[model samples]
Target: MTDPIRIDVWSDIACPWCYIGKRNLENGLAVAGQDDDAPQVEVVYHSFELSPDTPVDFDGSSADFLAQHKGISIEQAHAMNDRVSQIARDQAGLHYRFDIQQHTNTVKAHELTHFAKEHGKQLEMTERIMSAYFLEGRHVGRIDDLVALAEEVGLDGAAARAALESDAYLPAVRADQEQARGYGINGVPFFVVDGKYGISGAQPAEAFTQVARQVWAEHQV
Candidate 1:
């Protein structure tokens, strides 16, 4: 019998393509799991922040941050964001409101994801964080906001708050970062399929489906 395929995904909540990639992976999973011969796939999400130096309370919008940091005009930033939004909307069913998104550091958010992983709710936490950042425009860098998001996902609000305050999952977050570095990964939305194959960017659903089947076939041989 072939072993189940385990995929480790390294991504950032603030990354627009991460969410799109996640959705594409899901779409691929649906295709891959259509037959009894399909390999059972297990997914694990790891921490990867795009902008570690961003302030918690940037005195500007997400577009403003992009404009300043990327050395582009505000109009150009808006155009870029719009293009991404259109892709996300058409391809992933995600509504990205970059204009109102809070540009902030994601380390704390990564720490909270680790916290959720301990409770076996890592995927749920990941979805919520990405949705909050891209769609709801929530402030995920703040403890209060993170705690609220945790509670919304059926986690203990007080425990989440305490975890953040004490930096309980900081080490785990760092460990994930170290692993990413060891793998020579320097980008977001990167997927490691069965610890062997690496898939980069928000690839189409068929790509993930093909990988799953190929890996399964190789394992069974």
Candidate 2:
């Protein structure tokens, strides 16, 4: 029997494409019908902060951050975000309000994800964080906000708060960053399929489907 496919995804909650990439991956899995027969693939979400140096309370919108980071005009940044927002909407059924976006460092958010993983609710936590950032406009970089989201997802709110306050999962977040660097990854929404194939960006569902099938066949050796 073939081993279960292992998928490691490196993403950040603040990244719109990460959510789109996640949906595309799910669509691919559904199209492949691997859920019917295979010992379902194992998916692990890794931390990848797009704006590691962002302040806890960013003073400006996402446009401001992008403009500063890329050394471009606000108009150009807005145009770029608008295009990505449109693509994300079509791919993930997400509505990104760039104007309301609170650009903050996601390091603590990633640590909370690690805490969720310990409680076997990593995926749920991931989804909640993504939704909060993109759809609900929650302040993801704050400890209190993260604890509330954790409770909403059925995790221990106090524990989550403690983890954030004590920086408990900081090591796990660092490990993810080290792994990404080891893999030569320098971008968000990077996927490693079956621990062998690498897929980058918010690829088309068909592309993901093809990779899933290919990886499955190879594992069947």
Candidate 3:
């Protein structure tokens, strides 16, 4: 068997574009090759905080959080969020409920993600976390909440809860951030393909396909 292509994804759970980028990458894979002929790829998610300073329980709505955090008017924040939400719905097929989203720190959530990775459920946990935050209006900052979500994805709830409480994967999250800094990545949904090619932002599916096919051709040579 040939080696699987490796893709390192640096993104935040709160970033809507990250999810959009994930969808685009999937579409790109479908365009790149068939189920049998497609290059084997492993997507490893890393931690990035869009708002590291966000409180565990923000006192207001997502709009209020954005306005206060970015020093913009609530009206402006709502408009921006609306535009993003529309894009998610139309282009990405993701339902984003920013109005009800819990604006909180994602450090612990990243920790849970690392835990899920250790248990071989990282992808499922990552998707579930993003969906819970963006679509289901779940508060991902709390340990109890995260524990429940972990269990929903076939992980041990109590173990996940204990890990979070202990900050078990905090170092891994920090290390991932340090690596991002080393790579000079300051944004979410950044993709590093095969440790050589870098794809930034929520690029179109064609972009991913081109990169995937090009990398595969080179890798096969």
Q: Please write out the lDDT profile of model 3 over residues 1-221, one tens digit for every residue.
A: 77888999999988889999988888888887674567778889999998888889988999998899889999999998999898888877888988688888889999999999999999999999999999999999999999999999999998999999999899999999999999999998999998888899999888888888778877787
lDDT (tens digit, per residue) of candidate 2 on 24-47? 888877788755554357789999
- Could you give candidate 1's per-residue lDDT for residues 1-221 as a string of tens digits? 55789999999988999999999999998898996797788899999978888898989988899999899999999999999999999988888988789988999999999999999999999999999999998999999999999999999999999999999999898899999999999997999998889999999888999998888888888
TM-score of each: 0.96, 0.95, 0.96
lDDT of each: 0.91, 0.88, 0.91
Q: Which ranges in model 3 have alpha carbons more than 4 Å from their true place?
A: none
Off-target runs (Cα >4 Å) in candidate 2 are: 34-39
Q: What does candidate 3 score in Cα RMSD to the true structure?
A: 1.2
Q: In model 3, what are the clashing residue pairs, if there are any? A: none
Please give the TM-score that candidate 1 achieves against the real structure: 0.96
Backbone clash tally (model 3): 0
